[model samples]
Target: MDETDQAIVRLLQADGRLGHREIAEIVGLSRSAAAGRINRLIESGQVIVRGVVHPAVLDRNSLAHVGLVVRGPAEPVAALIAAREDCPFVSLTSGPHAIVAELRTSSAHELDEALSGLRGLDGVQGVETLSYIEVLRDVVGPVGETDHRIDDVDAALLHVLQSDGRASYVDLAAHVRLTPAGVRRRVLRLLDAGVVRIGALVRQPGRDGQAAMGIGLRVSGDPRDLLEQLGALPQASFLARTLGRYDLILTLRAYDPAEMLHGLEQVRGLDGVTETVSWTHLRVVKETYAFEGLAP
Candidate 1:
């Protein structure tokens, strides 16, 4: 990606619903040129802009990370883990474990059933799970908004953009019987209300040998101070305070194993952190930004 592409990506990263005109003004390009650049980014698999529902609106609220030790090649097992609807993230990495997967379910029973199913998969050796009590922060936006109360028209727009964040205003208007301008207005209202978040979902560029890792920190002291410190780190992506065997869950992306290890050590060395466990994410199979709440 070039400098202009990078700037565009950054803007969309903040707000995928931004207009080409707004993006052009910020990035110093013609409106058409900005639109074309966004299209290229989407087509090149560099970014995906879409409407992401708050977990509060979903039936599946339980979230957990599972680490797997495979008996043979990890790719096939990763594929199997990826195929499951609840397993949104599956990776094969070089670490203490062979495969790592993230599971989202509606209840504790569902979580257990999903983990059991993973254990029963062919070539699976063992499974370790870390259930999330709560997510403090995520890639999409802040947590703790459980207002599943959108009206029919707004719901329709969300359903449409749940699949295509960059869906045209005309198409959305047709779906909801609004004018193109009306659709644009409603979208902005929803975004401003924090009822929905739209942004590009892109993989961490591996150009610099970057790797993503999951860290479980066991904390004995007040977590706020430690969380603030960890949150400021550049590599930190997802940070959560949990109530399981571990107190905090962190997701970080580093240039390589050494950096990843160093990052872990830095967390381990923090004041509130008592112990630490880490896993590397090799591949991400499915991300659950799309929602079923607005579906018919």
Candidate 2:
């Protein structure tokens, strides 16, 4: 991805639902120009813009991650299953030797049905279930754009900030070819407009920093309310509900097994939580969001 692509990614990362005019104003491109760029990005499969609703919030508690350890091959199975709308995340690797997928649904019974569908698949062998007690969502690749405003200078500033949020006002001013005050004002506008999420990229320490342990949860009560309450917690890094043994699936970081177990316990102890399963970070193998390429 080049400079322009990175800028687009940043804007979407902050607000995937941003409109064409808003993106154009910030990217310093014409409305048509921005539209064309977004179209190309979407067509190329480099970015996916969608409304990821918490299934439980919608009363669909069937969510699951099916870790498939096949015998003969994996590529075909991965390709075949990736087409499922319920299959939001897919990964392929040979370490644990399998093609694993993170699937979603609305309830546990639906999850059983989904599993039945998977088990009926030709190459599928085994399945491990992880229950998600809580799911935390963040701006991974843009969501919606209720708040956004960008001008030529603002777009230039955002381009710089995505590369380094800590860049000084003076440095940003120089890079964007704007006066110090102009750059500062634009920066303030971006913040006020919510074009970029400003926060520390803090690591939880140890291997946890390197691996995203996926956990699934089965819960009771109003599943969506439970997910919303859990999503509001500080420890939740990523959260979603699916169909299977668990109603929710989440990613977390920890130092060791003990930490992971502790985190799992905390999740299981929630008011409406029924149970949970903690999976070791065997391997991420596949994640489109982790591509980190503004351009493919």
Best by lDDT: 1
Summarize candidate 1's per-residue lDDT along 1-296 as a digit string, tens digits. 77678678767867887899999999999999998998888887767788876655566689887778889888888887777777766767666688877787889999999989999989988987777777766766436655546788988998998878888999999999999999999988877777788876665445325466778788877776687789877667789877666788898865556767777778888887788877766566556466565753
RMSD (Å) of each candidate, 1 decimal: 3.1, 12.9
lDDT of 2 by residue, 1-296 (tens): 45675577557645554677998999899999998887776666555553233243223345455777776877777777776666656766434437667656767777777777777678888776655443346424222242454456655555555444446678988887778888777766555554544432221122223334656667886668676666654345667665556677666654345656666667777888777655544444334322111211
In candidate 2, how many Å is residue 63 off?
15
Off by over 4 Å in 2: 1-136, 139-145, 200-211, 232-234, 241-246, 283-296
lDDT of 1 at 210: 49
Q: Report the poorest 10 consecutive residues by lDDT, candidate 1.
A: 202-211
Clashing pairs in 1: 91-283
Give the distance in Å from residue 243's predicted Cα in candidate 2 to where it truly belongs. Answer: 6.5
**Overall lDDT per candidate, in order of appearance:** 0.77, 0.58
lDDT of 1: 0.77
State how far residue 89 of model 1 sits from its true place (Å).
2.3
* Model 2 worst lDDT window (10 residues): 287-296
